[model samples]
Target: MKHKKYQITCPYCDSPALFRPASMVHGSSVLEKGRYLYICSRWPACDSYVAAHKKGKRPMGTLANKELRHKRMLAHRALEELQQSMHMEKWAVYLWLQGHLHLNEEQAHIGLFSEQMCEQVISLCRQLIRTSTGTTA
Candidate 1:
């Protein structure tokens, strides 16, 4: 895979981000999405990590702690439901976000959003759903 290089640093703790095998980070590679993770050196204490490409050479996004990761997941769900309900293509949903959230293409992805951005996105999605369906969301 042609992957972009990243100079990743821990977002929570200012520790060095190290490329480690999924086995080292998750204790098992089974069911993992990628072959490795960019884990914070603080590891258990900081609890920050990001998935890497299949070759384990490039970071997927900025490092996220547990809470941020959970928020991102919620953001993803909100975005998905909006697209499915609206019968819009995946890119169409993103285009809506680009307009409402004032986000550029690179910043429009949920995976790269901060916790605050995730909350904003979820709220916007709910409002959009409510308005479109004329139901409480």
Candidate 2:
């Protein structure tokens, strides 16, 4: 796959940033978002960050504040539950999400989603799980 470089910036402050390990960013051995994380160069003031994929420096998505990060986590959990309930493979669940959300494959990731989109993911996942399992989810 051709990896596209992400020009990540603080959503709040619009500052230049750096992509490094979360441990370095936090000044501690924090393994929350794999080993790689992006932080605003003006961090401590801007407080924006994004986690990279486990194996690469590529960001998982756009930089976010605490609120957006929480919403993304909620969406991710709901997606996981929905996938398990439907007994679907990860790629298939992502395909379903892309089609339902009117997103192209490249834009289907929860990490790239807004708060509204995250809520939509939870709602859709609930509906899908309920129908698939024939029980309220």
Give me the candidate number with maximum lDDT. Answer: 1
Q: For residue 69, what is the lDDT in candidate 1?
A: 86
- Worst ten in a row by lDDT for model 1: 25-34
Model 1 spans with C-alpha error above 4 angstroms: 1-5, 135-137
TM-score of each: 0.86, 0.84
Clashes of 1: 0
RMSD of each: 2.9, 3.3
lDDT of 2: 0.84
Error of 2 at 136 (Å): 11
Residue-level lDDT of model 1, residues 18-129, one tens digit each, is 8878777677747864488889999988999988877637677789999998998999999999999889899999999999989899888887889999999999999988
Q: Pull out the clashing pairs in model 2.
A: none
lDDT of each: 0.86, 0.84
| Residue pairs whose backbone atoms clash in candidate 1 | none
lDDT tens per residue, model 2, 1-137? 66666677777798866877688666565444458778888876777788888765788888888889899999999989988878889999999999999999999998899999999999999988877678545
In angstroms, the error of model 1 at 16 is: 1.1
